[model samples]
Target: MKNTICPKCGNETQELYDGRCKDCFFENFKLAELPLVLHAKICATCGARFNKNKWANTGSIEDIVFNTIEDALFIHDRAEDIEIYFEPRQLSPHMYRVKVEINASVMGMPLHQKLKTEVRITREACDACSRISGGYFEAIIQIRATNRQPSPEEIQKCMRITNEVLERMHKKGDRFAFISNSAEDKDGLDIYVGSTNASRHICKEIESYLGGSFSESPTLFGRKEGKDVYRNTFSMRLPEFSAGDIIELRDRVIEVRKFGKNVTGTDLLNGSRFLAPPDEVKGATLIAKRSTAANAVLVAIENNELMVLDPDTFETVTIKKPVLLSAKAGDEIAVVKTSHGLIALPEEVSRKNNL
Candidate 1:
């Protein structure tokens, strides 16, 4: 090893960095640099931060302040084994004083630098929040039922599904996944959504949970930035019958257990499992619900027949017994009265009564 003389300071040293001794090189070298003041844009309603020319849901106000400071911090390229720490003091709700400490080594020499900056938070509406507040919507979902009005329970379930899907989409970086408005009409429920893609997802989830199908149609709403803008309307039709509904089709009486693309139920006439497509049961009249059945007195039982006293009229009537019937003589049994005659319900219906 040979000793070298620094040209700038005239000092003797074993090594020279950038034509200067270690002491002279370090005298003017800047280990770290940061602006005295920084600004952070945040949404007043959703608490989202604006950074890198975009808005994001980046945690709390303190985290946003720290991130803003870190993005603006500049460290020397020659520094190695660097470590940084931040100490923040909240001066007010919209202002913060942060002190940054940097520790590193340059040319095998330990170096430390402390910098201070003030972060001013400007609260305003982001793009998504602005659009939401302006009642902007890209799609509308109409929840309806086939051959009947949507029940309150069904409507509520649909709304729940919509919210869940929108929330998931938002977390996945879809800022426009939000509900703008919702209205209840005599026909059904109408939900206005911000994103058409999110609306499609909501409809699909609703159909999976409930039994139904949906169709989408786009209407030219206006022009934006020299481009045509179209808004979509999703029409969802729920299944005609829900669970526990007793329907009569042609010559068969069926108790619906589930209804989707395919209808599943137990035939009340013979207690056999019934499965058919929606079109097969078209015009099936909803005769009654298992919940509305009345208790009748069981008098006797013959081969494949049950003798029961009618609930309305105390006349002993003999009806064809269902295979699932488990009632004994002198006991009460569930029976539904129709235009045909008094009919004994299956054991599943009786168990529902206890529940």
Candidate 2:
């Protein structure tokens, strides 16, 4: 029988069961899983998840339960060891569904992507097995993202920036947070921040100087600032001045009652030298997120293994090895997600089969 290719996009696809491609099925059922947010069903036969939101096909799922709750075994620094409980995707023994449960899985994200995860099937504690006295069941071995798979050193630059920003907030009592993974309301922002109105003016000034963005998140993001309170003050009048009571601004001497900043260039009783031209600031950068879904920046990082996208063209790429990267700005790399922060790459990702 001819294998089924993705009829929709004409790509070779995975077969979980029956004979439909996962990616094609997902395209047909957009927004299928609202709560889970899975793009596709990894294994459709029995609701088992092979990978996190592979957005593949139903039967194509290899049978993995993501965020499958189980009793914790032991706690390590960044990961935990646990004995998991799960069932197979294929109902009967004649058919089998490859199911796996990983440890230290929070929500659906595997902790750090470098822990040991083994897949085993303990059929049951049925009467026949109970009498066997601690009988051993069949166990299948599985692999993690980094298992004898040589991976590049995990870069923590984003973490460093996040922590640094948090430090700045703490000192000034400001509010901020990493952009939520599923925040669709915020079309152009990667991070949300809240600050005093006074601080906002300062923040905006800093943004103009440093270059980047600072936009308001949606109402769901919570109050941006505390309520403003007005302080009562008694208005005061200045005492009368005598003739030639000197008033000075840089190189100009003006009458006390003359136009206060109402003075423009020629209106300047003050000379041009009285004002130094706008400060020749160092070069600044402007980072504006693309507002639409169609246009995307295919930026590749130069000199470094990172890439940044316009969020519209964000397609996560996971490779067996760290991809080659150019660390120079505008150098060009495949825009991809690596279980890391949004960054650009040094080179466009070649097909795994092609590589």
Candidate 3:
């Protein structure tokens, strides 16, 4: 090993970096370099920040300013184990002053420097925010029932699904996945979505969970890129008869257990499982809700009928016993009085449903 002397300072030292001793090297080295001012593109509506040509969630103004300055900084490549400290102050609504401390080691020597800079928050709506502000939407979701109006709870469920889908899409960097507006109508709910694909996804989710079907229709709205642009409308039809609804179909009292592409239920009169098409269920007449069915006392079970005492009327009546009924004589059971006659419910269904 040989000792080297710094050419500029003429000092003799063994620790030399870039043909200069540690002291001279550090003296001439730039600890940190940054632009005089940094610009931050922030959305005024959603408070999202634009970074690297993308809109992203950001922290407070001070934190954003500090981060912007730190990102734009260029530390010397020779500096090792570099650390930065930022002390920021709000100078005005649009300007921020930040004092930065740079600490690092250059060739086994400690180097420290402080730099002051300013950050200007340029308020401009990001792409998504701008579209939202202008009431822009690419698709509309119309949730309607097959035969009757949807219940409020059902509509709320659809809205919740929409929010969950939007949140997931947003996290995946789909900034256009947003709901512009939602309106409750006489038939169902209308949800305006910011993206056509998102609208389709929302409709699928609603159908999968809520048991329905949806179709898409596109209409020419305008032209883009020298071509015609079209927007979509997703019409989602929910089942008219939901679970726990009693309906008269095929001259039999049926209880709807589930409804989707195929309607599944149990015949309340004969206690036989039933499966039919959505159209058949739609044509069926809604008699009463399973929620309104009353409890009854099973006193006697004949070959094909059972004598049950109605809890409300306190009268014993002979009703058809279902094959699926598990209750023995003298056990309490659910009974629904239909227009034709009284029907005894199976014990399994009684335990399964709250009613």
On TM-score, the leading prediction is 1
State the lDDT of candidate 1 residue by residue for 233-306, as single tens digits: 99999988988888999988888887876888898777788999988988999988877778999999999999
Q: What's model 1's lDDT at 52?
A: 90
For candidate 2, write residues 218-331 as lDDT tens digits.
222222367443321111111121111223334333222211112111101312212222221112111211111122243443342333444554563222222343234443
Against the reference, the lDDT scores of all candidates come to 0.90, 0.28, 0.84
- Better structure of 1 and 2 per lDDT: 1
User: How many residue pairs clash in each candidate at the backbone level?
Assistant: 0, 33, 0
Output the number of the lDDT-best candidate.
Answer: 1
Model 1: which residue pairs collide? none
Q: At residue 163, give the lDDT of candidate 3.
A: 94
Lowest summed lDDT over 10 consecutive residues: which window, candidate 1? Answer: 346-355
Higher-scoring candidate on TM-score, 1 or 2: 1
Cα lDDT tens digits, model 3, 12-64, are 88866787776776665787898878899888887788999888877777768
Number of clashing pairs, model 2?
33
